[model samples]
Target: MDARITKAEAALLLPATTIPSRRLAEVEAIRLAAIAARDEAVADGVRRAGQAMLNAAEALVRALVTFPARIDTYRALRRLSDRELRDIGMTRFDIPRVFDPSFATRAANDSPQAPQRAA
Candidate 1:
């Protein structure tokens, strides 16, 4: 019996004995790419959320800054006489509503001066 294998026999068995290093490398590369993509998506989400928070903060600051001015305007309107208020197309009662965002629409709906919409 022969103790050593021939070159042809070794060549035939080479593929079975060797590890699939190239396939393993490809799988590893794909895994790394997936991790990189997931990290980028998370970073993008965090950036968008931070920007939204900053915008909300800026809006709050602007509202706080303008609040005293709105109060001053309201006080000035309150000081006016009924005749003076009427001259401005508003009554003393309407002064409080002047600062309301929906004032124009509400006044138009409630005013005697507004034209009647036919049924």
Candidate 2:
């Protein structure tokens, strides 16, 4: 047997080396694709979180901007007499409950003094 390989032998061996290299390239491609997918998921999560924070901030700003108007309305309502309040389906006691979410329901259910409007 010869110690040196001929060109024909080297050519035949080339495919053997290339097969493993091709497999390595395919594995690298799959790994890169997985990494890209993970990064995209993380980016989407961050975007959603940022959007949620922005929505909360907008709501807070809206509340702050409307606070003085709400206070003014409360004061105006407070200045009304019992007759005026009754006509409007409210009472001096109901003034503090104006900001409560259940105020309308509670008022409708509870206030016997609330005048019935003509149909």
Candidate 3:
């Protein structure tokens, strides 16, 4: 017994109402089903590619060693302009937190150009 069975093989197991014509119809049905499955797999591959990029970015942010290296990595991620990164997911400022915890905290609290904003 062949371990692998295709849609056409499964259809062949069924009793044919019209003997000769049934084989041709079953083959066409299996071919169409195979094409649909292939297209779905292609679409899934593209989706996984995009998700891999986001996972890489997140990992890069988490693996910064020094301040300068962190800054460079943050800039690269920022260049993507992905809103998911901007909205508390990840940001350039998170880079400084590794080197200067206070600086990161203060920046989060204080507004840049505070005096200008007052005027």
Candidate 4:
């Protein structure tokens, strides 16, 4: 009796096992751990972004609500013509709208007046 085998034939006859079952188990564990870590990181980022956006919105609401007088002052100043502002014991230079926006609008609305700028 004589037996002969080619490398190609041997390879074809061998059972395919790219990874041993134990190693496959380890690889699957690692993959699952990595996926879990990635999910946690993504969730944390979303939570932080949501919190920051909420903070900014709250601040905007407070600014608009608390500073109504200041906004009104600006409107009052705007209503005055450049020439008129110059005449009424005020001036574009003296009470520059940029420096004190609240003054112009203080009297225009029924809203409570802010403390007047001391003369």
RMSD of each: 7.9, 6.7, 14.7, 10.1
C-alpha-based local distance difference test score of model 3: 0.66
**Candidate-wise lDDT, in order:** 0.81, 0.84, 0.66, 0.69
- Candidate with best lDDT: 2
Off by over 4 Å in 1: 1-20, 81-119
Candidate 2, residues 68-117, lDDT tens digits: the string is 99999999998999888877777788899898778856644358665455
Cα TM-score per model? 0.54, 0.60, 0.34, 0.44
Task: Show model 3 residue runs off by greater than 4 Å.
Answer: 1-20, 61-119
Candidate 3, residue 7: the lDDT equals 96
Best by TM-score: 2
- Candidate order, lDDT descending: 2, 1, 4, 3
Better of 2 and 3 by lDDT: 2
lDDT of 2: 0.84
Candidate 4 local lDDT, residue 116: 47
User: What TM value does model 2 have?
Assistant: 0.60
